[model samples]
Target: MSSPRISVILPCYNEESYIANAIESVLNQSFTDFELIIVNDGSADNTLSIINGFEDSRIRVIDQENLGPGASRNNAMRIARGEYMMFLDGDDWYREDALEIAYREITQKDCDLTFYQMINYDDETGDIYENDWFNLTTLDELDGKVFGPEETPGSIFDLSVGVCQKIYKSSFLRKINAEFPEGIFFEDMPFFYYVYLKAKRISIIKEHLYFRRKHDASITHVVDGKFLDTVPAGQVLMRIFIENEWYEMYKFDLLAYKINGPRFALRYIEEKYKIALYELIKKDYTEIKSSQYYSDFLENLGPVKKKFFLDIIASRNYQDFIKLNS
Candidate 1:
């Protein structure tokens, strides 16, 4: 078969209930030159069966064991025969013109990657809500111009740490050897930073081009031991910054993230699982206290936030962590 102009990869694991919509969205896209690569990550449910239901000449299916989405994307990316690529989650669908719009901008403006907008779909309520997850004003300020990683300070951390919302040049990704961090729940954070740091130029569009499903059972909502992966996931992010010689420029952000990120994760976890999470956070936070950036973080945190951050770490147990915050 001839190479496709664009390759769209959909990765899913037991997403039987939502896979069909995602498949249809790609099949029904206004741009027809793209190939759809569906990675069935060992779904135990009817997800594979659902994927096979579609009849499209452009569709390619890869059946693999239950590797995480990171591995799924990495595996698919290596084999994709397209000039450009984008990712789609099994539970989410794209706007009909998403590929067309993103392709037009990426090609016309000659950017390494271009990310459009996204709206949240609350599966429970069927509500489609606007999410200004990125600083919208920042994009507006760019005024349709392409900007490099250095052009925007700390931009590697500013945008939504999700890849499904962006379209990347296949060659640029290959050139930089961008691979998602595998075997982790929050791998997207590290991979996102790694790419932005290597990206030569990128564009942003205000047009909403994707629907991100939000539901009770989805990965984002269903908290478990996997949530603890955020710590190591963050460690990966820090290593990327340091490896790229960006630590001094963004260390304050990293220190603040160390302080606030885990707290946010623990808040939603069941009280039963809070202790393990606390132990991990306590160890992580305690170990990093000696770093000058840690001291810089506390020094600049001001009185109120400092006390709040300290109180979280100083807790004797998860209960005290809860009670102190409460």
Candidate 2:
């Protein structure tokens, strides 16, 4: 058998209701020279059975114990045979021409990786919502930006994490050994940042190429009384700040984390500060305090923002802190 142009990986868990449609979306893609690898991550539902029902020989099913999406993707990448790899979540579906367009850019333009925008769909109502957060519309706008080299890293950190909406040359992925951290929530932020920094050239296609389903089951979703919610996903922001040494990238993450910390802290302390959570943030700040970067962060925090931090420390919860802001 000839090698396919792209390998599309779908990591499924308890998505029996949606897997058939997700599979149909990929099988129906305008580009036929692609392989689909669906990793069944210990789904208790009929997900595996539905996947087996597919007649396409291009689809390969790999059954494994539940290890979360990050690990499931890692397994798929390990055996992927295509020259390029596209990771899609099983519950979400893509536009017909997404792979065709992305692969065309990669092959013809010699771009290392290409990322496109996606629509957000409500799982309950089946209504599609366009995404506001991802800006994938124009590649020409980012022309002059330079990534350092293959060995040294640059700072276009958004590309690595959102695997589904992006196309990556298999050779580049092999060189970087890209994989999300297992057992961790928000695995993409770190993994994506790392991969983007290492790539020679990255492009963003602003078109909406995929539909990202949003509902109760998504990792990004928060629900009450669920173990995925109640269980400590830990303080991911603080860990990122402390573990990563790239200051340029560090500053970008810290700027966001620091701004959001007080809100997290308010939520943490309000709910009865877990000794673990408090230590995570305080220790993270303590470790980075002496870095000139930390001082730079403080100097850049405008008076109002500084006051907001102080208010968060003084007030009870986010709502009270908002009242203080008003």
Candidate closest to the true structure, highest lDDT: 1
Cα error, residue 164 of model 1, in Å, equals 0.9
Candidates in order, TM-scores: namely 0.91, 0.76
Clashes of 1: 0
**Residue range 1-326, candidate 2, lDDT tens digits:** 98999999999999988899899999999999999999999999999999999999899989999998779988999999999988788888989998998898777767677777888889889897774465442333564343233322223432224667688989998897777778755555556656665677766666788888888767656422222211122235334445555545456434544556333443534344443343443444455565555666566566765565455455555456558766
How much is the lDDT of residue 132 in candidate 1?
61
Q: How close is candidate 2 to the true structure, as a TM-score?
A: 0.76
Global lDDT of each candidate: 0.83, 0.69
Evaluated at residue 44, the lDDT of candidate 2 is 97
Q: After superposition, how far is residue 16 of candidate 2 from its true place, in Å?
A: 1.2
lDDT of 2 at 143: 42
